[model samples]
Target: MSQISVVFHSGYGHTKKVAQSIAQGATAQLIEIDNDGEISEQDWETLNQSDAIIFGSPTYMGGPSWQFKKFTDATSKIWYNRGWQDKLFGGFSVSASLNGDKQVTLILLQTLASQHGGLWVSLGQLPSSSTAATRNDYNSLGGSVGVLVQVPSDADADAIPSGDLKTAEAYGKRMLDIVNRFKK
Candidate 1:
């Protein structure tokens, strides 16, 4: 089986919950960037050995968390040697506002993967028509590049919307499928 890794940081439990769902659906390994914006040597090695990488972070100030940015900076060596060249890449993000500029966060991830010479994977899920969509509908927030999850500012992480979790899981599975197909 192709090995995949989900590298991410969660400021609150909400992002962590979504990441867990993604990992479960992908059957992928997890390498979390710590609060101090550092990853272990083992995490680095794991990322280097992965067949695919799915990035994730909570959107902060219209961008990815600083911790995830730190991890990206740490990947410069891998980028230099083309260690991740042509590998499949995907990303996901969560935020408090309905329009939290979450797209910016995904763009950052896509850029990082591109700099590594990785092949980008779109979410591959059709968005619900806003006219007909419900709050719990898949891709309700209409993200095509990556999964976007919105958790109310005051809501507990455990109370995240089911649709968002489902979207994340589906994105994970799609990423895995793309990785396996290209591995042939």
Candidate 2:
């Protein structure tokens, strides 16, 4: 089976939700960027073997967490060798505020994928674009691109609404479809 790996850092579990959703849609492995800035060597091997890589992180201070940044920096060795060249790449990010400059985070991720000579995929679904659309709408554009999730800073993990989770699952399924088609 073709492989896909999602490497991510989650400060408050919101991004983790996104990662889980992506994994559910594909036969992919999930690697968490640890607090100490490490991914297992086994995961590195998995990455090397995979046909696609997806990045996820919480938008912190207008960008990704320092842990995720450090992980990205460590990829310099791979970058030098173009180890990830020709691979499919994609990303998703979550933030507390609705307008938390999440696009900046996504750009940073896309740029890194580009540096590795990878193809980037955006969230394939369209925004709801209607006044009657409610928070429960499938494609509500509350700053989510491809599985964009939003959680109030004060809300506990249990308080995360079901709509966000469903959206994330749909995004993951969509990504799987895209990767499968691209490979063909």
Candidate 3:
């Protein structure tokens, strides 16, 4: 089976919840970015072996968390060696504010992947734009970028919308399907 690696930094539990759903659906390994802004050597090895990599982080102050940015910087060594060239790359982010410039965060991730010569993959699923679709519809416009979960600053993990979680799972599954096809 083709391996997939998800590396992310989550300040609150919202992003972590989305990452877990992605891992579950893709059967991919989850690598947490440590407080020191480093991934375990073993996890780095897994990324080297994996067919795809999915990045996650919460949008903070119009960008991704500092921790995630540090980790990305550290990957420069890998990039020099063309380590991730041609590998599938995807990303997700969460924010407390409705328009927190989450797309900027995704663009940052895409740029990093491009710098490493990786192939970027967007949320392949389209939003249900029909009037018949409700706010809770799966893969809605707001659900783009794997799962852009929204939670009030004071809200707890329990407050996350179920729709966001479901969308994340589906994103993971879709990523795996692409990985499997490319492996063939």
Give me the runs in candidate 1 sitting further than 4 Å from their true place.
none
Better of 2 and 3 by lDDT: 3
lDDT, candidate 1, 1-184, per-residue tens: 9899998899987888888889988999988888998988888888888999999999999999988888888888888998999888999999999889999999999999899998899988888767868758888888999999999989999878888888988988888888888888
RMSD of each: 1.0, 1.6, 1.5
Show where candidate 2 strays beyond 4 Å.
142-145
lDDT of 3 by residue, 1-184 (tens): 9899889998878788889989998999999997677888899899999999999999999999999999999898999999999999999988888667788899898899999999887787777678887546676546455567777789987776776777788889989999999989
Worst-scoring 10-residue span by lDDT in model 2: 138-147
Mind sharing the TM-score for model 1?
A: 0.96
For candidate 1, list the clashing residue pairs, or say none: none
Q: List the residue pairs that clash in candidate 2.
A: 144-148
Candidate 1: lDDT of 133?
A: 86
- When 1 and 3 are scored with TM-score, the better candidate is 1
Error of 1 at 182 (Å): 0.9
Top candidate on lDDT is: 1
Q: Which has the greatest TM-score?
A: 1
lDDT tens readout by residue for model 2, 1-184: 5688889998877788778877887667899989887899998888898888999999999999999999999999999999999898888888887768788899999999999999887777767668887667765655444556677898766655566667667766766777788878
